[model samples]
Target chain A: MTRKRFVTLTLIPAIGLLATLALVSIAGAIWFSVMNRTLRSADYEFVGLHNFLRLLRDRRFFNALENSIIWEAITVIGTLTLAVLLAVLIFETVKKPLWRNLICFAFLVPVLLPRVAAAFIWRFLYSPSLGVINYLCGLVGIGPVEFLANPSLALISVAVVDIWQWGLFFTVILLKLLETLPREPIEAAKLDSARTWEIHAYVTLPMLKGPLISLTLVKAVESLRSFDLIFVMTGGGPGTATETLDLYAYQMGINMGGRISYASAMSVLLLIVTTMAFVIIWKAGKKWTN
Target chain B: MANITCKNIVKSYGAHPVIEGLNLEISDREFVVFLGPSGCGKSTMLRMIAGLEEVSAGHIAIGGTDVTDLPPGERGVAMVFQSYALYPHMTVADNITFGLRRQGNSRAEIAPRLKQVADLLGLTPFLERRPKNLSGGQQQRVAMARAMIKTPKVFLFDEPLSNLDAKLREKLRTEIRKIHMQLKTTTIFVTHDQLEAMTIADRIVLMRDGQIEQMGTPDEIFERPRSRFVADFIGTPAMNFVRAEIRAGDELCASGGGLTLTLSPHSFPDLVAGQKVELGLRPARMELCGQNSHNAIHGTVVLVENMGAEGQVITNVAGAEVSFVTKDFRSLSPGDPVTFSIAPDHIHVFDPETGRSLRKD
Candidate 1:
């Protein structure tokens, strides 16, 4: 085949995607202008950069922004720490490949489950009255405690569900990374009189830095976009305490009212934040690997 | 440095035997090599000695202590693997002093040990570099230095120089010999390369099919092999084998070939006249005896391999392919009928069926 034909075949998908993006951008610009016309010119208008000034005064927006940051922080640290710990433990302790594979399979079950289904499953388990957790706590003389029902505990509860459902994803990936590492150096370390803990600390841990950074980047972006699990578990309950940007956009655009333009604005903000996080992570990864 | 001994060592995987009831004794300060082909239990034997492989039915003693049940570290033997097995993440200094640090040695203790080993291996310049950043020979030195700094009872090398290029192999080969000489540490090196075994070993233990074929000094094994197998295994271009039979007139004749030579009847006086035998001649032993020379055979030269400084000439002798090496490269060419003879003392007679050398007691 000629080089031109090859180039056409490869570029066709990119061209198609760009065309769709251009058409969507055109329709969106027109719709945004129409929406801006109905509102007052001072508060919300097509006047360039006016809404950004109002956005600075928005309390709920700031609260959502703070919550998003806190959410990402907790998720990234929690997932990476737990995943690496679990992977290292299984790598050093598990001798049977079959048993290790089975454990990995069990971890992947949560990641494979539909997000809504997993959230609901966790919701039932955390239900205050007849939930197994409360019932078990009662055996230890503890009273019924609101997990997702309490406004103070709502975000934490949502994070717990996210960690439980997707922590396995990190565990499995990192576990494979650990298993594929050369065994000879570790053997040499053992011969070198390195204690079990020292082997993990000096040898295995340093080797795992690459995989850990990669998993952190992926799980951080994933946590920022997480919507289904939190929605099903808490519905931003009690005082919009667990109101993430994704839930806020859904609540405003679809559930509360047809504030499509407002939700779109929130979406553009989420997209920018996520894109910035990804670009930083990609750059860091490139620096590390290079 | 300490001596090591294996008593009735046996190892098997499931039902297949790898090391079958083997035994060996290594004296203190001796550089010993287990020379064999792949899958001949040489590495298995070394691993058992290092406590890396379980001895199925034997006891291992190091420095007069029974260590068959001990772990590798407690056995006080450090091993340099074929892959170097240097921790890629650690700098050269850290890799060398890892064992000392783990043994609860203070930085004061480890620092000097590291410095001494690094200096010994000429690795002081690369102390801060990681193993992956170093050349293969340097990495091998790092591995040796790591094992050395531990000051174990025995140093075990499992084909340590096999991964290097030919030039580096020779360079590291001499370096290893010099290190062994300086340290005077008891070492057991395992390799399939006969050249490495011959060049570096104080005593070479040749193994085949999970058994020791012969064990002796390099000179003894090379000049006087105990069996046809050892004769065939030790030399480069390998020893040539030609089947022969004792004829009615008590002459040695090349079997199925029209070649005849006088035999010293006293050499095999006990064997029947018609008994079959094999003659062993190293390539370097066979010389270009002149035409019409006594006990000489005329052979058509088949191929002339002119390596620098020497030549390996393959010839068709009495329908048998015989190879010989000569210092004079231009002395012979292919298709030339050349006469060659081997001295009676240079010739090894073997029982053709069992491949055992027939030594006169």
Candidate 2:
């Protein structure tokens, strides 16, 4: 082919892609501009900083914020640790290629399930009288204790469900990372006479640092945005238990129970917190991958 | 430090056999090299001896103790793999000390051994550096140090220098030979390079098709190969073979030759009158003989290859092409008429059907 035709062939698609991207970005810019204008013109009157300052004074907001922090902490830590453990277990145990693929496929089922559907399923399982857990406990001669109904158990119950639903997704991703890791290092560790525990502690775990940190940060972000399951299961019931920031935002913005601007402020705060977390994790992961 | 004996060793993957019953013995402090083409099962044999692979039907003994069923760690053997197999996350020091530490040796005992091996391998300065930070040669040295730290009974090398450049390979080959000589550890190395086998091994085991064709000293394997496979594999510009029939008459001669050569009455006397055979002659064994001389084969030189120190003359003889290696880079042009004769003592006779050398009295 002549150089002119070759240049035209290459540049045409590049130019088309650039034009399409520019047009899309312009549309997005215009949409954001219109939304900002609409938000400015809204009749929801608010005193300057009054919503944010009032959120600070609101006892339920404080309670929801505290619960949200604890929920995120528990979910992120529990999800990452359990997911990594499950990934490693499946990786080591599942030898048949088809079986391994099937297990990974099985783990992705929970992630694909709608959060509300999963919450409803768990709500039935966590029912005070008819729940399987209570029935099993009754086998041991225990009382039919309340799960989502009790304030003390409600947050923990919600966190457990979040972990169950999302832990497998992280495990699937981490299993991929583990599988693609260089086999030479593992073989080297074996030749070095490293026992299984030492191999996990010294070689495998250290090498998994990047994936582990990234998985934790991503799970943290996902957990912080937890909403649907809690909404379906407990509905922030039993006097503000399990009222995470996402629940708080939903309550204030859409529910008639709280102010709208204050929820927007809370969403902005969440955006800042997640952004900072991502930046920190990104920098650390970048240092490692480099 | 140890003698390794492999008796009728065999390895098979389910129905596919990798090494068909092999027997080999290495005396104490001998550097034995398993040299062969790829897929010839040399490395497989080495791994079998290292107890890394299960031996199907044989007893492998190192230092006169049966170790065929033992694990690699318990076999008193250390192997340097082709990939160097250095732990990427650990520093050179930790990598070298890992095996020793695993033996539950105290820190004091491990430190001296680690320091000794590190210093011996010139890895002291790089002890703190991780494997990825080290050069290829340095990583290889660290692998050697790691293997050597245990002072195992037998050292197995699985093409450890194949990943390096030619210059580094040569340098490391010499270093390994020196180390072997100084330490006097019975070593078995596997490589496809005959030159490396010739340079480092006290004995070379030439294998083909998952079987050892010949095992002898390098000079023996090079000079008096027991089979055509060994002859073709051991040398660079391999030996030339020509199909010829032994003639029956008052005097034995190659009848197809323009000028017939008289064979010694005592040589090849078991004479089945006219037998079809293949004549083997090393390139160096064919000398330039006078034209029209008896016992000389006349041919025309087709190509002259001058490779600096040696020149190879390719000639057409009896409708077949044959090469003659010479140190004298004569200005022989292509298509020049030449006559050559094989040195009677160096002429190898092989049974055409079996490809095995004929035993001559």
Candidate 3:
């Protein structure tokens, strides 16, 4: 068989299937964004650009957008710092395979827990009346701090659950990357008279930069559109203190307001942000790998 | 340049000892090769000398300064790893001068040294490239340049050429020898390839199981291997081994494998009557003789491997398969009758109980 025919015969179906699946989802989102479909009724009307036009004056939408940016910035930064520290600490200190694996598996428990289950677990842990966290704060003579109640602390409190789950997730991935990295360069650096911090700064961190950036971008996108944990924990709670774009959009479309087309416009904006993130990831990966 | 001396070095991991009672001294600007098979602890010794591995017991001195407790960097030694552990993100020039940078040399001071080593290794054009973009040989040259840029007092190489193809390995082996000559730094190279050790080392130290078996010039190692392991390991196609007994009658004779040879009593004074001994014969010393030749072993040819100029003929003599290289094997085939003769001076006799050569040099 000719090379082109052989390749086409083997590859066309998979590519076509993937393309169709992606097109259907994107087309569905675009179609829904312009239609006034609601959970209250099966009937819908085509309202071209009306949902997007309403968004220009929506204060709640702007609040959700700003909250999303803040939440993503906090979640991505917090998770990365904790994950890298955890990965490096366990990888460097725990020499015994059994102990290292146990530590890694323990940290990975949050990732394996269902998002709703984790949210509920943290909800109890954050309870002002009976929470272990407030109880600990009480031991330090501080009164019960309303973790998910105060307007200022609600977003950060809900975002902590994500940082917990995804921090360990990224930690496990970074640990594997650390393990797979060739160790000779570090040893060579030692023989080259590099001091401890200098070796880490010059050799080790530079080696880890590509994978670290990729993980950060991935975590950024994940936190930007995060919903289930916040929805379960605070339900965008305590006067919209933690109502990020994803949770607010979900509430508007399906649950409380039943404004499906307006929510779809917000979802389309999120999709645009995520798509831009993916492009940046792809381009960064290409640049670094080369 | 520094002369290195390792005195009664012992290295162990937990209860398992890898190197035991190892002692050696390398003179200033000498090129020495630690030649051994896998698990022989040749690399362990090299690492100990480099201060990468700590010795459980011993004193290692560099230029008469005790460096046993010193770190690798403070020992003033530079090593080229077998993996060519060049930084993937750094350009070749940056990688080469990293040591100088770490040593707190200013950028102006490092620039000329980097350029010199790059030119020396023919890596001038590749100085801007990352290691992954370069070929294997080029990467190794960059590794060499990295070590050379340090201008270290003692140089260490741990099987640096084993990662390359045959042609590249050969080319680098010559290049390494040339660099050693030009720089005149004390050098210790570890390798399992006997040919590589033979070609590049000023002195070859053959090791086995964490102990030095024999050490000498390459010619001495090839000509007068003190042990059967050394003989069997050093040559291509390996030396042929056979069991024999000393017949101390009117004239001392060694008899084995349906062949008997007269031995000079002065050479093997330790031989006694009815004593079993192991005999070693180099492939190049044996040749095919006429069918009715006197004092020859009669054997059937088993297989002939033809290599253009010389062929190796495996012969079965008294149920033992002996292989010897011969240029006259072109007409020979398996199952053919053959007679073989050995040069007397080249015969090697070892104590069967000790595996040590009985013949005195």
Q: Kindly list the per-residue Cα lDDT of model 3 for residues B85-157, writing each as its tens digit.
A: 9988899889999989988899999888888888888999988888999999999999998998888899999
Residue pairs in steric clash, candidate 3? none
Q: Model 1, range B1-361, lDDT digits (tens) per residue?
A: 4888889888998898888888889999999999998999999898888877788898999999999998778889999999999888788888888888888899987888888888888999999998888999999999999999988879899999889999999998898899888889899999999989999999999999999999999999998788898999888889988777767753644343545555555564565667788878788887788887766867899999988888888999878888888886486778888888776667777888898877653
Top candidate by lDDT: 3
What's the lDDT for all of these models? 0.82, 0.80, 0.88
Looking at model 1, residue B250 earns an lDDT score of 36
Error of 1 at A161 (Å): 2.6
Please list all clashing residue pairs in model 2, or write none if there are none.
none
TM-score of chain B of each: 0.95, 0.93, 0.97
RMSD of model 2 against the true structure: 4.6
Q: Could you tell which candidate, 2 or 3, scores higher by lDDT? A: 3
TM-score of 1: 0.91
Computed on C-alpha atoms, the DockQ of candidate 2 is 0.42
Number of the top candidate by TM-score? 1
- State how far residue A167 of model 2 sits from its true place (Å): 2.9
| DockQ per model, Cα | 0.70, 0.42, 0.70
